[model samples]
Target: MSDKINWEYIKEFNDSIRTIWMPFGLPEIIDPSHSRFSNGVDIQPAWKIPPKIAISTTITGAMFSSRGNPNHPMTLEEISKSAREACEAGSPIVHIHVRDENGYNVLDPEKFHKVIDPLKRDFPDTVFDGCMCALDSAEWPHMESFLKEGLLEVTPINTVAVLYGDTLFAKPPYSMIEKTKICQDCGVKPQIAIYTDADVDNADRFLIKPGLLQKPYHWIILAAVPGCSPMQNPRQMVEGLMRTYNNIMDIDDTASVMVCAAGRASSYLATFAMLMGLHIRVGMEDTVWKWPHKDDKIVNNAEHFKLFKTMAGMLGREVMTPDEYRRMIGLPVRKK
Candidate 1:
């Protein structure tokens, strides 16, 4: 054997990568005659996104309209419009959370219509993902609550889960697989989210026969929750995610991973996640400040995305556009 390693194959593989931008593949605006839905609908540049960064608008300007918007409140039409504008800025997967009439936290499906309706109307081309978090109990009895009171009534264009520690099952914990079934039944892909390694393990553990859990999940690592995960150890953050994703892949090769942000990890872990060939998720819900070091400074979701895009460029990586993301994730072509 030659002293040179298998370098030829590596070079060929590198050369095989086809990199190009797929602009919405539609015409531009001039004297506007149609209101988007007219003339077979064309996807515009504004409603497009770089594939690498799937901006999670949940915590940013979602649910609530503005930073100063009152608690126990619902998002205003202007705020939803702003969120859609942010989507236009470049959010491949727009993560949405609907505010309840209570105004403190997200509500069940009662207001799901009210929230998703405007977003669908505005960002018809962008992929919108909704949340289905069971904040109360997780007993067999509570399953119905999550369905009847939580995510049953509404049919999201897409569904997401935020299963957290100490929120549902404890002592070895259980899975809310029922939620995913409901979502699949509703014809929406589940945007499954996890915080810790075990949470991901739970997802990995329950792929096929889910008695109480969801399997075959589209995973997102929401790094460092307010009280659950600490933001100090970036290395630990990477190691834990590496272990979890690698472990899941080892068992089931089909699991797709998304690296999400919460607070300071939102600022720092962007590169590490990119290094792992994963996507980023940042928004107001995950973090309120622009960067970890900045003192109480606020940045909007789109701006945060631009920040991450700059990081990717500095590191010599290409951020995927909306069309690329849809193709990569096996999602359908977004209609204009």
Candidate 2:
């Protein structure tokens, strides 16, 4: 079983990723503001994030709050501020969700620059992985326009998978082809996020799309979600990922994938994901700890990191620092 797992192969890949995101100098610490949807509670303090977390070819981290509310709705005003806080907290790359004046999630054409402009000015150092919500009635042309004009660094998500099977995009602003072309034209990497082992087919369809995917793509596994089926068996889950990765590698040896598990099952899935040489995304984005079960309700950010750390240690995986992350992601170094 140990030989079958390919621990050495996985470790070599882990080391390469670490070398890419080597450790770097710490980022600035700033004051945090209200989280508007925090039920009106104050935002988590700036002191909450450590000075720096991990390193690769450059030191880097996936910056986030210990108690960030996954259930919280983000506004442009709120997201703009929230994103800045993450930047100040030493996150070079920030995953974003745009919100509106009334705090509803809207994708109005006029609102794009409202968040991007000011954010670029204040936190120029941070790389923004801008997003357009699939929940909203967003289309491909709109996605195309966002990439061409928004000047966003990366798009952490895309509607390509949603486009293949759903009839929901039978209207303007939702053309599947143009959205994909814009991404290729813009050279933004798509983070393939899936709900179940079967959903890996979504990624398969992505490869067939014209010019949507080039060689050497990145993928993410999203476990145990509502619309997506549940993965209760750890053995099946891990094995599927390995096989899926092998299949992707058959297409392109440079293919990469990661996991972002949901619910209480996240901790174990996260560990398994990392043990296999994958990146991580842990925050309030996926689950709310307000549920009754102690792990079900809200657990703090440190606990998640501790879990990640423990699993990585047991598996002989070294965490990537901020500097390492920058090189891996190809972000330019900050001038001192």
Candidate 3:
């Protein structure tokens, strides 16, 4: 043993650290043909984001109770109407979570079909996605049935359980695997919902290695879910964004990632992501508030979407049409 520690070993180890931009292979350079870049004013090159941010309209969801807001859409008619408004407002994809007549969350395939079928038929161009949040094995069949019928084009798959205080969401690794397989078999793409950094690590280690998760992986980062890492504060939101960005950057460049928040942070973080040239999701599902600190109440998903549209406009970013979004995310382009 040496009397003094070897400083040369530490130097070599520190110098070996490097960052990889594209891990698997180089992804096609995404061009911002549809985006409106800042032209008149000189802007920093690093400040430029992709011109078009693909937005998802989450029709009816609240961080708290189903009846959290008086204007929460419960009936299929109201849900469909909200979705239509969002589509018209520039949402290429709409994410829905069906509820009962009393505004309670339920996973009934018939209810899902009733709402999704009509909107898909009417919109024709919009893609419909959903939350397959089956907490127990018994609930899996119902969700699986929805996928089998081709009612959903994309569905969310998370490696870990989402928690609210002491309550655990109960998404075992096996369940995630089963869900991923079902999506693959049914031709429904998985959205790989990630709530924390560990989830991303799991994707890199287990999910991708077995080919359980596919390329062009769509990710939804749940930044401010209660009992999850809190992102209600602006500084915390930035930190969360950096952490997510670093983790995903380490995973794959081709992966499509989006940011969303529950309650008050919803619009703020979403707007930030939009300005950063990343995808964003907004609706009553994440929050019932129209602005930060719950300054105003949101009437419906369309209202939430319109506000986001204003933000995108101010930032000089164009919202992608359904077809443009489809092409960007590796989905089939629908005939216009």
Best by lDDT: 3
In the range 213-310, model 1's lDDT, one tens digit per residue, is 23444566665654444556777666766776676577556655667666566566756777666677766666555555555544556666667777
Query: What digit string (tens of lDDT, one per residue) describes model 3 on residues 86-154?
Result: 877767789988777776677877788888777887788888888888856777799889889888888
Please provide the root mean square deviation of candidate 2 (C-alpha atoms, Å): 18.4
Candidate models: Cα lDDT each = 0.53, 0.50, 0.75
The residue-level lDDT of candidate 2 at 268 comes to 61
lDDT of 2 by residue, 1-336 (tens): 656797877877764555544333224133255433346565665342222223101011111222344424354555555555555554445555554565544555566677667767877665566555434344545666667774665664432232321333221223333444566577655555555544455445544344465544666655544443354567655675566556555655655565664554555656566655666665445555423235464343334444555556666655555445545544445564
Where does the lowest 10-residue lDDT sum fall in candidate 2? 55-64
TM-score of 3: 0.81
Rank the candidate models, highest TM-score first.
3, 1, 2
On a 0 to 100 scale, what is the lDDT of residue 330 in model 3? 67
Clashes of 2: 40
In order of lDDT, best first, we have 3, 1, 2
**C-alpha RMSD values across all candidates:** 14.9, 18.4, 12.7
Candidate 3 regions off by >4 Å? 1-48
